[model samples]
Target: MKRGGAQHEESIIGASLVAATLGLSVPAMALEVTPYGAIRVATWWTSSTYYNPAGDPLHDADFTLDLQGDSYVGMRVKEGDFSALAELGAYNPKNRSAGVELRMLFGEWNFGNGKLRVGYAPSPYVYRSEMIYDADGGFNGYASLFDGRYAQIKLSMNNGFYLALMRQENVGLAGIGATNSPTTNAGNGYINTPFNMTSTTYMAGYTDFDTFMPKTVLGYEGKAGIVTYGGGVAGNYYKIRTVAGNVQTGKDEIYSYLGFAHAKIDLAPFEIKVAGHTAQNLGNLMNNAAAAAGSFYSNNPATGKNAYTYGGWGQLGYTLNNKVKMFTGVAYESNEMRGRTSDDRMAAFANLQYAVTKNFNIVPEFAFLNEMRSAAGTKQERIYATGIKWEMKF
Candidate 1:
C-alpha cells in the first residue's frame, strides 16, 4: 500500500511539471487577490453644552459607545506595472446610524520613473503623522486645508513632483431672505450683512452649467537625510447665479486659491511634524463647524467675492519601546471675514497607544476644543475616549 501511494504522488508531480512546460498551468494564469479589514470599539464623552444647548444645563455631559472609527475593508491587486485598490468604511457625518461609504478606489499604471492615476483618492496635500488616537488629526488639523477625496486625473514622478485636475462642486446656499435667495426675483443678489457687522450670511449662488469648471493643483515633495518637506497650491473657480422668481437673471464668477507647506524630521526616538496653509473660500475643504465654502464675502455686491482663511497644526511623537507610543498635537484655524464673531477654532490633543498583540491595540486619548465663536455662542468642549481596535488580513 505504501509503494502504491508513493507511485501515485510521483505520477501527479510529473504531470504538473509537464503541464507547466506546455503552458497549461491554471495557477500560473490566476491573478492574486488580498482582503483586509479592521474593527474598533470606543467609549467617548463630550461636554453636553457644546453639542446639545437645548438640553438640561445641569447635566452638562454626553457619552456613548461607538464602533465607527477606523473600521474598514480593502482589497489590492497588482499584475506587473499596473495596480488597483478599493477600500470602504463606515461613515456618518450626523453621528446617526453608520452607513457604508467608499473611501478609496483608484488604479495606477507605472512606467519606470513615473506613474498615472485616476479615480477617487486622497489629496496629495496631506502630511503623514504618527498620531493614531484622535479622529481629527487629518480631518481637522492642518491637513484639513485640502482634506477631502476627489475624483481626478494625476501624474506623478518618482522625484516627488505631481499635478492633478479635479472636479469642483458648489456646496453653499444663500441664507433665507437674502438677496441671493432663490425666492428673490432679482437680477443681482447680495448676502446680507448685519448692521452692526457682528455676523455675515453666506450666499448660495446660481448653479448654471456654464459656471462649472475644473480645479488645478501643483506640488512637489523631497527628502534630505532625516528631514522631509513638501507643499502645493490650488486654484478654484466659483460662480453665483442671480435668481428672479425662479428665472435665471445673471451670473457672477469668483476665483479662489490655496497654498500649503509641511515639514517633518525624524530624530532617533522622536518625530515631529509641522504644517500650515492659507486659502480663500476654503471652508468646504477645512470642514470646520462655523465655516463653509463661499462663506467669506466682500460685502460689495458688484464683486461678490469669497473671503480668505488660514490655519496650521503641529505634532510631536515619541516611541517608548516597540509596544508603546505617545503623541501630542495642536491645531488652529481662523476665518478672515470682517465683523464676524467667534470665527476662530482651536484644538489640542494627546494620547498613548499600547499594542496588546500583533493585531490588537489599546489607546487612551484626551481632546479639547474652544469654539472661539459660533452661532450657539462661545463654548469650550472636552472629549475623553478609550479605543480598542483589532485588524487582520487574509
Candidate 2:
C-alpha cells in the first residue's frame, strides 16, 4: 500500500511539471512594437523671400538643398486595448543646424465606443487634409486655424465627437501694435482704458503672459457615402504683464477665440478638399503674423481693440494611375482692417507625385504668392517657387 501511494504521488508531480513547461512556452499577452520613419531629400528654389515681400534683387534667386524639414521617426506600441505613440523629427527654421522637434508623445485607453488620450498630441482644431505635405499646410494651408500640437487631455467618441483642454505659450502682444516707443500710427496702440498714444510702449516679450485658463476645443466629425466633414471652435485666455526695466508695471487679461470647418469628397479617381477659419489674436497659434501678407492681430490705436482675420484654402487631386498623382491648391487670408501689416495674402500651388516604388516617391511642385504690405502703402508683392522632393518610407 505504501509503494502504490508513492507511485501515485510521482505521477501527480510529473503532470504538474508538464503544465509548467507549457505555460512557459506561451505568454498571457504579447506587446507589439512597430517602428516607422521617412527619409527625404529636396532641392528648392524661391524667387523671393516669403517672409519679406519687399523683393531684394540680390536675394531673389534663392536655391538650396533641404533634408531637415521632412525627416522624422516614430513608433507605435500596442497591448490589448491600450496603446502608446511617440514621434520626433529634425526641424531647422533659423539655420542649417538641425533642431530636435517632438511631434507626438501620447498614451491612449480604449473603451467601448470611446477613447481617452493624454500627453502631447495633435491639436483638435486642425483639419486633416492631403495638402499637409509642406510647412505651408499647417502654417497657411487648408487647416491654418491652429495647426500645431500641444499637451492636452482629450475625450473622444467613435461617433465623431471630441473635447480637449490644452496648454499654449503666450507669444506676447508685440504684433498687436503694442510698443515701447511713440508711433504715429494712431490705429495701432495697446488697449488701455484712457488710451495713451505714447504710454511707454513695451515690446512684447512673447513670454510675458501666463496662461490663466487652458485653451478649450469642441468639435464633431461625420461621414456619408463619398463625403466626410469636420469642424470645431476653440477659446483661450491669458494674463499679460507689463514691465519696465525689470519692474512690473501692470497686468491685463486677454481673451481670444477661433472657428474652423473642413470637408472632403472622394470621386473615384478625383478628390477634393476644403478648409477655412476665422480667428482673433491667433498669431501664436498659426504664426500668421510673420508670413508675408498673412493676417493676424493689429490693434486699433484709437480704441486699442484687436482685429479679426479670416482665411481659407482648397485643393483638388487626380490619380492618374496606381503610381502617379497630381494636385493643385489655392489659399488666401485677410485681416478685417485694411491698413494693417499682413492684412492680405494669397497663394497657389501645383504638384505631381510619381511613386518610384512602394516605399519611394518623387514629387515636383510649383507655387506662387501675392503679399500686400500695409506698412508699405499696401503695395502688392509677388513671389514664386519651384522644387522637387525625393522621399522614402519604412
Candidate 3:
C-alpha cells in the first residue's frame, strides 16, 4: 500500500497558485482553491538489506548486515476532478552508493458515481489491498511504481464498476531474484515464484503480463447500516506484435491475470476488514527451470505452463467522533519464485483530521514488515517507518 510520491515541485506549484490567486486576502489560505497538496518530510534510521546491479546487492551473494532507508519526501494533490502525486527519495547501505527513485506522478478525472473520467494514472494492478479507507473507499498497495503510469480512458458505471485499458508496466510477475531478465519497473519483485511468461522482445515471440496489458475493472461499495462493504474484479489481455516481418516463436502467450475481494465491518469500536487476492502468471516454475538447464532464462517459455500466487491483508481501526481515526493491519503473501518464499508483514496507520478545523488535519502512520525468508522464502528482514501528512480544502 505505497501512497508516497513526488512532493517538492508539485506541492510548491499548488501552494504558489494559492498565493498568487488570493494575495493576502482575508485569512490567506481561506480563499484558496478547494483542492491542494503539501510537502511531506520524514527522517529515520534502520539496519539490513539494500541491493545493487552486479548481483545480490546485499553482498556478493554472501553478506549479512542491516542498512537504512531514511530521508524521503512525497507530494499528493486531490482537487475536484484533477489530481497528481510524486515522491523523491533515496536509500544507502554505506558500502554501496545511492540512486534516484521515481516514486509516482499520475493524475485522474473523477466523475459522477466515483469513476475516473480519463488521463494516465498509476496502475492499480500494483496493489492487492486498499491504501486508504473509511466510510468512503480504499486503494491497493504500491507493488509496482517504476512500471510507470499507463495512458488510457476510463468508464465508470454508477453501479460502482470502473474500467481502463492501457500499456503494460510490469509484464513479468517474477520475484526480486528472478532468473529471467525483468523489466526495470519490476526490479526486485514481491513474487517468490521463479518462473514467468513475460515477453523479452518482439520477433522473439512476445506476450502480455498480468499488470502491463490493457485492463477492465469492476467494483461496488454499499453499506448495511454502519457496516461498510466493497469488492472489485480485474482482467488483463495478453498480446503483442513482432518488429520483424517473420521470426515466429509462439502463436499465443500464456494469459497473465489477477483477482481480489475485500470488506469493512463496523462491529463497535473496531472497524475490521478481511481482504484477499490471488494471482497467477502464465508459466511453470519447475518445468521452466528445467528447460534452461536449471538456470533462469527467458527461453523457458510458458508453453502450456501454469503457475500461481496469492496474498491478503486485514485492517483494524476505530473511528473517533466524525473525524479522528486510527488503524492497524497484518498481511501475508506467498510467491512461487526463488525456491519458495513468503512475506509476513505488519502495518499501523492513523488519520486524525478535524472538519471542525477547516476540514484539515495531520495524518501520520507506521508500517513494519518481516519477510520470513524461509521455505516459501518470505521477507527475512524487518522494515519499519513512519509518516506525517497534512490535508486542506478551500
Best by TM-score: 2
The whole-model lDDT of each prediction reads 0.60, 0.65, 0.42
Find the candidate with the highest lDDT and give its number.
2
Tens digits of per-residue lDDT for model 1, 197-309: 11122234333322255678899999999999999998776555554556655555556678989988898699898888888767533333435323344434543346667
- Per-model TM values vs. the true structure: 0.75, 0.77, 0.53
Q: What range of 10 consecutive residues in model 1 has the weakest lDDT sum?
A: 194-203
Off by over 4 Å in 1: 1-26, 51-59, 93-98, 128-143, 173-209, 247-250, 284-304, 339-342, 375-394
lDDT of candidate 3 over 160-197, digit per residue (tens): 55565654433332221222223432432324443444
By TM-score rank, best first, the candidates go 2, 1, 3
Candidate closer to the true structure by TM-score (higher is better), 1 or 3: 1
Prediction 3 TM-score vs. true: 0.53
TM-score of 2: 0.77
The positional error of residue 20 in candidate 1, measured at the CA in angstroms, is 24
**Distance from true location, Cα of 370 in model 3, Å:** 1.6
After TM-score superposition, the amount by which residue 56's alpha carbon in candidate 2 deviates from its true location, in angstroms, is: 8.6
